[model samples]
Target chain A: MQGDPEVAVLRLGHRPGRDERITTHVGLTARALGADRVILAGDGANRAETVADITERFGGPFAVDTVESWRSILREWEGEIVHLTMYGLEVQNVEAEIREAHRERREPLLVVVGAEKIPFDVYEAADWNVGVTNQPHSEIASLAVFLDRLFEGRELDREFEDAEKVVVPQAVGKRVVEADDE
Target chain B: MQGDPEVAVLRLGHRPGRDERITTHVGLTARALGADRVILAGDGANRAETVADITERFGGPFAVDTVESWRSILREWEGEIVHLTMYGLEVQNVEAEIREAHRERREPLLVVVGAEKIPFDVYEAADWNVGVTNQPHSEIASLAVFLDRLFEGRELDREFEDAEKVVVPQAVGKRVVEADDE
Candidate 1:
């Protein structure tokens, strides 16, 4: 899990019962796509538990936590802030510059993904306002593509440690085995 | 609005109220990430309506429909079938071959994305079972990354015909104007 710049995802605006699954997906996507941790900034405690459970079951150095105030994290963050939004600059256009600021500069990266209708200040707070595509789609998808671009697809080869279950990739079948078997 | 191969996404096994937003994301992701259409196979009529509404407002050649049988669509599809699954072959390893089949060989591509548990028959049905990353994340994320890789990122520049609202990419603010304004 040694990447140049430590990456964290902040999941903003979790509407308790309604966004549980989407919030969980955001956290899991953060873990799977090479982010070191995710801070769930609202009432996403249960979603944190779900992500934590997945990490425990499927090996992780990844962390998930619930925070009361997202603004404090943004205000105190030491490195770059990237907000993924449909209204932001296209990812392809800005990815290389952001990647250099992140990796070459060795600055820790905090990626912010919001639920519907993000506050205006979040955009102002961001060092890079990025869009995977200007067309409306899932925030999970945006985050996934953004991370893939940020890491330049090397994140896909990442192997997690201390996993109970590990997926053995198949061509035409499903296979999940003990990590020892891997 | 022309690409090498016509791509359609099939969302499999959606539960009514629980999967409403996720299914909507699946359809929207398909549309935004350069797919021609999305076919929701289960109880996703309302999700189709939402996607259609977005298309009407944002402009699209994208189509969304609710289908009675996912199996029939798979059987009836005359092109290459790729199922996005965590248990499938890694996308990075197989994308070139699949791309050649779809683009160079002139085969239409059917990308299948499933909810929680897809049946074994689906594994058998797909010509290529592709995984964006062999880790549990959102199917919407998997579909997005898969399409991004399939099209090699050209889809980000796509323009929709006759759109009322188009996002004007910004550095730190939101601005969506009429497509005519462009």
Candidate 2:
């Protein structure tokens, strides 16, 4: 996990009462974009169960968990923490530097995505506060762009292990194959 | 518009009965990520109005329109078309080639994003049918990645001509400034 800088996503401020779909997408996007795990923070309803369902249905070498203290998590992480925010350094400007550092150190990477009013401490704690664009946009989009750049687009070919369902690429129609389908 | 690829996004297969937020994001993402215009295709209720409202509130050098025939639009487009689908070629693999061709030909880029079951014709008609990743994922995410790569992340610095409200990047708190604000 360390050699290639295995990536883990930390989704902060999940408010299920407001928009569950967005929170769910935070985790789903992480998994789809080649993150090895998703850590859901905040008191979002059924956050763990929801991610569990996704892993169960999609099949995964992925993990999901809920945490109460994102600050502690950030402070304790063994590798660099890349915080996705609009106020930070533009991603393109610093991505290669971060990637090189991670590879050389052979440390895992933790990506932080915020859902609510992010505390300033989080910003200060991040080794690299990266912005996909210096504009307020969806966190999902920022994570997608960041991961794409981080991996140099090789994540597109990532294969999920033990997938209960998988999409087969097609030129015309949509076809999803299940594990039971011989 | 031609030399640098004036980009237009066509959001296909919108249904009023379905999710509207996702459709709205298609337009918002396009504008935020650097598309010059977003063409909403299909009978989704208030699709055009939604995007227009976004432009009005968010500020814009961006435009929004609705069309009945995506095929007709595609057939008559003045430049090359790039259709986003999981079934398409990996974006990273083809993006450089497409950019080189578009620049050499001075052709604009029309990016097609689907909201429902896309017809086979789109796959065949596209100059480059591209995938951010060959996985069933959100359309908004795909559009972001595509635009980011197309512009080589320079889109991150694009400034809107007349933004009514804009977020001032902050290290801590959220602060949005209005055009008339002191």
Candidate 3:
């Protein structure tokens, strides 16, 4: 992710109590899937903390923050905007152009992932409105697949620095060793 | 998906009220991303109904069902079993083999998605314990990416039949039309 353009995921319209876990998953997925950071655009301070805790333990070049105004983030964003929605053009159709802009052209990417309903203006503001599949499902999943495609699966092999613990991938049981980097 | 192995997702150890939406998203992701069905291995009747309702509206050959004992379902399962976990073998390393057994050998696939902590036996029972990434993330995201990889990205091109409504892919606007197939 170092050489890749800065990728930030903006989680819009989080309903505090109802979306607590879902929003938390959104942040974690973004971090694990190669996004440099995530901006929570609602009252998701606690969710931000959960992700921050994971980052603290698991390691991070990842950042998580809470923002009061999502619209301004959109208006002031300096790079390419991609809105992930069920109604958008298929990701497979638009991934190449996007990857070119972000990876080849080195344009920063702001990916907008929404909750239940999104405002139309967000769609209009995006350079590409992309869908992992034009069907009903989880936004966390949408972001995961979209990022995977954007990185062309290289993110899976990524090793995090400054970690306190690292998973030792096993065939049959759990195994996590303390980070020797410390 | 028609000719592929019968893929079913088994969600284990669901804590009713707290895991409601996360479980629902699991079921929906399973359906939308090419799984033939999702077997909710807990008290997920309401969650099953929610998925069923979406299936009814969106069209499906997809099925959602609740089981009293998850162990029984796993014990009686007819084909290969895959448990998704962060501590498991990296998916990129094992996906081809898993795909071969399911796609070429025509063995059914039962993908186990866990809630909080999965029992050690689940790992032992699985033919392959796979991780989408050796990093912490959402199970819904793991399932979506795993299925996408297993299907080699063809699932996004899938068309659901008997749908009452279908999304017309857009670049910057929302559009849904009644399925004329009805």
Candidate 4:
């Protein structure tokens, strides 16, 4: 919430034992799709570390952290809140409005993605509850689609500044290019 | 390739031991994003059955099959070929043109998604080698982004007619609506 007006992600409802891989994917999707940072708000302390490790390995101008209470965080955010849910207005219907507001207000945009049964308070607190698709699917897919639209597809070209291992594009074979120090 | 002029997917380079989950996701992404059918090309005979089972359970107007030879299939394809790859032209740049061409020709689209190291011949055979992003990412993510863009996000609203279990959109809690017969 303290960063520049660039978009960030708030992932709530992570259940540690049940959501390890899914939670890590949420963070990965957020970073890969142009979020400047992610706040994992829930009881998944180990999940937060796993996500942080991914960021560290993949390289970052991105940050990751964990918080205990999403209710207080959502209530206190200074910027517009866009909660991703299946029941909300379609993303295409409201993305332009959200983008316009973000530009005019010049405040950080917090895009919320939930992992478990999100409490009713979140829907009430969000400025916009948007759905990438109404159908049931992976939250990772929803975040990917939402961020792609929010950034207008420009994020596809974004490059990580410090990746230790990078894929080298090939016409015939597989090769991962790693840092010389490795 | 024998289907209507609507979209179809060809998933190539399936490595059975390594690409089980990735290949399954490719099928899921294809079905979810509005492709009418997907042909699992190359090795991994069992992968075809896994994908077929998913479609059977999730409900589909979608079709799934497997083939041993992608080279022959690509050569004989009756429609335009659009291969998904990281080294190719960006999807946003070429998607409009591809869509326009498909419309004008009334040709079925064969969208190729690879699971392992794709051979060079694929690049040459494809009518358009489209990149969802230049970065190395999951094939599932790439397929999702590509199909969403191809259909101009309309696919987001599509509903499966026979899904045994469907997610009910909720603002506050999770509920999966199940078919009474099941």
Give the lDDT of residue A57 in candidate 2.
77
Q: Classify candidate 2 by CAPRI docking class.
A: acceptable
Candidate 1, B64-133: lDDT as tens digits: 8788888899999899999999999999999999989988899999999998889999999999998888
Full-model lDDT, candidate 4: 0.73
Q: Score the docking of each candidate (DockQ).
A: 0.86, 0.38, 0.90, 0.24
Native contacts recovered, each model: 0.85, 0.33, 0.92, 0.17
Best by DockQ: 3
Compared to the true structure, candidate 4 yields what TM-score? 0.73
**Model 2 residue B87 distance off true place after TM-score fit, in angstroms:** 2.3
For all candidates in order, the CA lDDT equals 0.89, 0.77, 0.91, 0.73
Q: Count residue pairs with overlapping backbones in model 3.
A: 0
Model 1 agreement with the true structure over A1-182: per-residue lDDT tens digits: 36567899999988877787888889999999899999998787668888998899898889997899899999999999999999999999999999999888988999999988899999999999998888888899999999989998999999888889999899999889998886
Q: Model 2, range A1-182, lDDT digits (tens) per residue? A: 22376799998877655546566767777877888888988774356677778678777777887887777888899988889987777787898988797677776899999865788888888888887766656787888899888887767777777778876655444567786792
Question: Where in model 4 is the C-alpha error above 4 Å?
Answer: A1-4, A12-25, A40-60, A66-76, A115-125, A157-182, B1-4, B12-25, B40-60, B66-76, B119-121, B157-182
Clashing pairs in 4: none
Report the C-alpha displacement of residue B73, candidate 2, in angstroms: 3.5
lDDT, candidate 4, at A137: 48
Better of 1 and 2 by lDDT: 1
